[model samples]
Target: MSNYQNFPPANEDGAASTQMFRAFVDEPAAQPPTAPNEGRRTGVIALSVIIALVVVAGVVYLAMK
Candidate 1:
């Protein structure tokens, strides 16, 4: 069996092994950063507002006829 599977590698001289361990453990976890959907969201909102206004105007025109 591999030695590291049983125990952490020795840091006998307090140098290389320790640096390697720190580099492995202290490294930040990889993450997929969230992206802002500002443009798409704004376009969707504008389209919804226009659709609502058109529907309201159509209803008003039908009621006035």
Candidate 2:
């Protein structure tokens, strides 16, 4: 029906296709990277509280039994 439905454009002109390719593939990949520890602090505190509560509950259960 349409040429796009078949082989499509191969970017033979190299300008619009290269721009499209870089826009979808390369540009977003060029984002500034974040530190491994950037957003881990809050999660660590919440997890620590959960772990501590479980530990305390276990200790109390053992003492009562």
**Which is the leading candidate under TM-score?**
1
- List the pairs of residues colliding in candidate 1: none
Query: How would you encode candidate 2's per-residue C-alpha lDDT over 1-65 as one tens digit per residue?
Result: 64665543675653577667767886544668777885798789999999999999999999999
> All models: lDDT?
0.84, 0.78
Q: Model 2 TM-score?
A: 0.42
CA shift of 11, model 1, Å: 23
In candidate 1, which residue ranges exceed 4 Å CA deviation?
1-34
TM-score versus the correct structure, for each prediction: 0.47, 0.42
Cα lDDT for residue 31, model 2? 69
Q: After superposition, how far is residue 15 of candidate 1 from its true place, in Å?
A: 7.5
- Among residues 3 or more apart in sequence or in different chains, the pairs in candidate 2 whose N, CA or C atoms overlap within 3 Å are none
